[model samples]
Target: MCDWNVDPEPSKEKKGRLARARGNLARRHSERLLAELYAGGTLRARRDASAVLAFAVALVVHALTLAVTAGGIWFIVRGWGGWGMVPGALLLALGWSLRPRFRQLPKDTPVLRRAEAPELFALVDEVAGTRGVDTIVVNDWINAGVGSYGVRGRRLLVLGLPLWEILSPQQRIALLGHEMGHYVNGDTRHGLVVAAAYRSLITWHYYFEPGEHDPLDEAATLQLIVDLLYVVPRLLVLGVLTLLDRLSMRASQRAEYLADRVAAQAASTRAALEWMDRMLILDSAAVTLGREVNRTSLNRPRGKQQTDAWAKGLWERLAADLASVPEREHERLRRVGALRAHSVDSTHPPTHLRHACLQIGEATPPAVVIDDERDRRIAEELADARTKVALQILQDGY
Candidate 1:
């Protein structure tokens, strides 16, 4: 992911001890990589031995899916009318689902076209230094980023509405700048082969993942046997994931530093610094996005009309809520972030380090400024989208 994936808290399922331990390890790994990179002053055109091995491992994972597919086809062809058909059928289904491929945008993904959002596209273009992105989109989130989608090398811009609604015009530019910067830097995770490989492993891991509870009619002993059988394979897959993550993230941390440098150029050093500052409290927006809708619904607006009004004003309410946050709270978040090394993920460098880097880096004027005219037009363009997202949030009750 190009961004902190929105700085949301780890999902409930991922809050287990194993996950926390993994996260802490990732944090430490990123920190060490950042320090090493900074000290080496080798910002670009460097790939360590481990990175090459990781690439090879990624291809192996990708090919394993293909191998499963081939094994299925062979069994089906060789044993057309025999007992082999049962396992063949299962393997076919599993292998097909596990195919390595780019992350395709959902058919229902809400998109903004150049024609529909000229002002917004103008800002995007400016942030990108006239580079064209394949898509600009919105979703229910408190984050934003640029990522590649599909095998054709198309780039996507996804703005988290809650994040967008709260940002200043310049901050918005900074956000786009940072994400766009990822394309310029060496974001190995965006690579088709590597990304697809990682995703395939994730799917495989999830598929064979042992259920916390057995099926109602299943025998416990049988389930235990099945689970025990999968334990070794699952552990092996997880180990590969950890190794790949560690290797790729070293480069990813360096890329983050480079992207921040680009962000500084795209939206000024001051804006980039402010961007890091805002990153510390992204959790607040995520929390508010969840609570605002549920709290409003709980308030029990009398009828459809009242509910619709509340939904329409959702962004305004969210913005106001953020505006009222005290500086002390901001400082507190910064402290907490520092304690955790201030990471968005294991891959990205800690916010404190990036912030300090920018503080001491060059100062520049913003390439694209967000004035009242620009802000008003972009907001007008996204008005329906904002309302729709609000309604979706209300409907989803999150």
Candidate 2:
């Protein structure tokens, strides 16, 4: 069985020793690889800032519109019934108070039943125990969309669908290792603080801002108006959050690198990196295929099997051709134009970018292979066991 038990009272020195051991186990060029990972994190932070700026501009424009409209509101509300402007203002204020800072944590968080999968819990606990840190709390939730989040107090929000798809046992270990790095590095706290600040700003912009009032109506009309208004500020906040997310993603990428390094030290960074690359490729392929299916369904002509067959056949051929290529070839096959086609409106970076990061020597230095045979055997065994455990948990007679 997988070793899930961790001593709750591990020391700092012990934690450091374990980390070093893990790092060296892969025999990678530790110093250089670490630098590259840190640098990538910095880049992600910059991108997150860009997203925030976009949201900020939108918020300002909204405020100005509200200000201009507010002047005429005095005239408009001169003889209105009901509670005059008070009720409208109150409701608007209340709605703003509840707006999410970033979109709800990715949607799939709820689906990955962590409670059922005991090994996953043990895995996280082991890392935390080794680090001499409190075990990060893991919970499942279906967020705005499917995604996981690391919060303060060593808390982890795992999206059900995303987790189900993302990693193998070794890769999952590496991913968890990366998350532990965030906890170790205080990133979880940073994320929460940033989120809180963004929430506060959004609350202020929506509720207290004098410019946001409806002119003749006293309140913003339509759900869209409220949505739009919220979007601007929230988007601004999301922009910031996105920036931070990118930063976090970058940080996450770094953490991935580090975890790979640790895994490499223990086994093979190449294997870990390769695993990550495959996972990303699969995610991108799934997204692309889903989009195609959705668009086809939406635009399909109102007809039966005969009319749909030709178009369906054409799409099938195209999909088959695309799917025929190896996952590693996604970057090579994806054109800049084609990349644009895929970039409808995703907060996360492009598939190629993720793919590019997964490539060794872009920023990461060369990793040394330890006992490849041993590592391979252990990885396979762990993976098979986890898969069985995960499957049983999923299929449990509830």
Candidate 3:
């Protein structure tokens, strides 16, 4: 017999408290680990610890989900044709509903071959040194990242053509080195798995999420009852997942610092610093440029020649803006802190901190030369592809 009349509020409260305590403990442990890494712990030590923790959590989650699913099925089989079957069937349905779905890496973006962009490939090789590269993908956004894809876990380097157009040759080298650093430090390998696990947990929570119900509605009573049955457990699960995500993010930040050190070593420290500052400057400039492009309908290019000319003009303007910035103003911009401090979920450390870290280490001179001809050739090769992506963005009204 079930005690349906019994109040569930007390149990809910207890679970809430337990979840909060666990979250706090996880946060504290993560912060302590981060502090140790910053204070003097080796990057490999911190990385290995975080990777182990993430893999353990992921395994536990998958195992628990499988057990619940199997138990539900067994109950259904044993309790067939009776009132006992109701609970078994319900449990089975819940387990199946919350099962994690397959997540595929994005494949819509254009892929560039080494033969198509030999100069760009040369730069990548120069920056990466002995590191192996599976592919280089070019997109239209002002972002870049290194990712592992497919069952064989091939490493892919995605570079934004717009970002490439703006950066000087030395800055480009620094950017490549920083991205390759993620691969070198094993951030790409372990971080991707942890991220996928975190995302799956979040997705599962949202799958069974209850919608808002009006308190005055006749069905509100039943809705409230269902909420009591469902929401508390979901919240507890989500809280734990959130805590794990925070730990993963802490590891990601440490990886960023390590990658920055690698970048500084591979490229000049000055180049790395300048590259970071350029990101901030470019972000601001991009906003203004976007508005102007929207107002002028820059996407409605009459022909390839027109598009190429407009792109060239846009690059010239951006370059002039970057070149005109006074050193003192750049320094001032660096000193002014962000309005909101980075939360535990943030993957990268603050730009100022990254700059300071780079300053600490001795750096080799940038291997790539600042050749305008090479930059021009790379830009020309990517111009048509960038134009197509830009048109798609405008068509989507983004």
Candidate 4:
């Protein structure tokens, strides 16, 4: 396990108190998670609401379509029950589309044997211990290759690539603290509950229809009609779900704050902040480069001769017309497009805001724990890459 020498000046009593407080919070969070998971009725209610809303709207649409086709208001009531089949088809499609992602709890024991880093395991044990919960498994494979901080099997996965390339030991500790916070707080169960609710919503119309309407019915035309009628209700439900997801994200972000506090309590606030910054930097770099690499591979130069000719002519023109332009000006021209893209579509609410949240009330200037020299160099490199990208955008007039 990795070792740290805490500042001896801070009394052991204070550390003990913070540890106790952190444990209490983790326990409360874990309990809440378990409650949410086991509370299937609540999820059923949400699902029922979605199904009823979709069916009612679709049923109305079907009635209107029949009324218009027959060209008589009196026929609407006579054939209204006939339109129930349309809602049924939509219900079937919805059920299929919104099926729960996982059927059973994922196990993590097998993943632990493959994990290479001893330090990460130690950190995980420490965080789990603080919550008074013993983890059955820690997954090693899923860390950097996919999204971070997700629950899978019975194991908590800390991606190896992200840990190895992006984080220092302190940052690694903070990252582990974040994941453990999710586990301790019962994020996995809440996630499953939400998924189940969504699934149940899709299947709701089947139960409410007047006659037996099969969601698994094979009639293409009937299904299409139902699908068309269900579109509005589907959109409405999706919009609401999107809002809920955003709310969940907000809650998750706050949980991140608590986790950071936990990590800081065990270690240092400065360490927590440093880890956050590094994660942002590494993630930004990965997204940018990963996009470009994927694009390049997919767009392998199919027309080499024509491209070469165009490139040669463009270079000659640039050399002749912009020879005296400064490197900074060229760089600015390249990145203008990427800057616009970042501004409009970025999911994260600015890095500085995240950093500020972590440093709510600490000493005058927070204690430094990591290597400033190396971090600055990495930052400079990333900035330079961004500058080049900006210049490319500018030259392209994007």
Clash counts per candidate, in order, are 0, 30, 0, 16
Scored by lDDT, model 4 comes in at 0.41
lDDT of 1 by residue, 1-398 (tens): 13242334533333554456556665676566556656764466356776787789888987888888888888888889998887788889989888765657856547887888888887888888876587788888778877777778688888888888887878778888888888877767666777888888888788768866556756877877888999998999888888877677666766787788778887888888777778777777778878886787678677888877888898888888888889867776666676556577655667887886665534888877777877888889998788778888877866
Estimate, for each residue in 319-352, the C-alpha lDDT of model 4 and write its tens digit: 2333344555434322332222111112222334
TM-score of each: 0.87, 0.40, 0.75, 0.42
Per-residue lDDT tens digits for candidate 2, residues 1-398, read 22222223322333343234333322232233345644764322223453354445445534644553563355337625645566556544544554334433334222233344444444555644453222222222111111234433434434222242344445554444444544444222134444454455455544523344455664546543656666566555444433434333333334434434444333245545554444434435455435545555566545555434533343244345444667436443344313332211222233334334445453443232224564455334334333333322222311
| Ten residues in sequence with the least summed lDDT for candidate 3 | 337-346
Best by TM-score: 1
Q: Considering only N, C-alpha and C atoms within 3 Å, which residue pairs clash in candidate 3?
A: none
| Candidate 2 Cα misplacement greater than 4 A, ranges | 1-92, 95-116, 127-154, 157-167, 186-190, 199-267, 283-398
Instruction: Tell me the alpha-carbon RMSD of every candidate.
Output: 5.0, 16.5, 10.5, 18.5
Model 1 TM-score, 2 decimals: 0.87
For residues 50-83, could you state the per-residue lDDT of candidate 3 as single tens digits? Answer: 5677777876766766776887888878887877
**lDDT per prediction?**
0.76, 0.40, 0.65, 0.41
In TM-score terms, candidate 3 sits at 0.75
Top candidate (lDDT): 1
Q: What's the C-alpha lDDT at position 246 in model 4?
A: 37
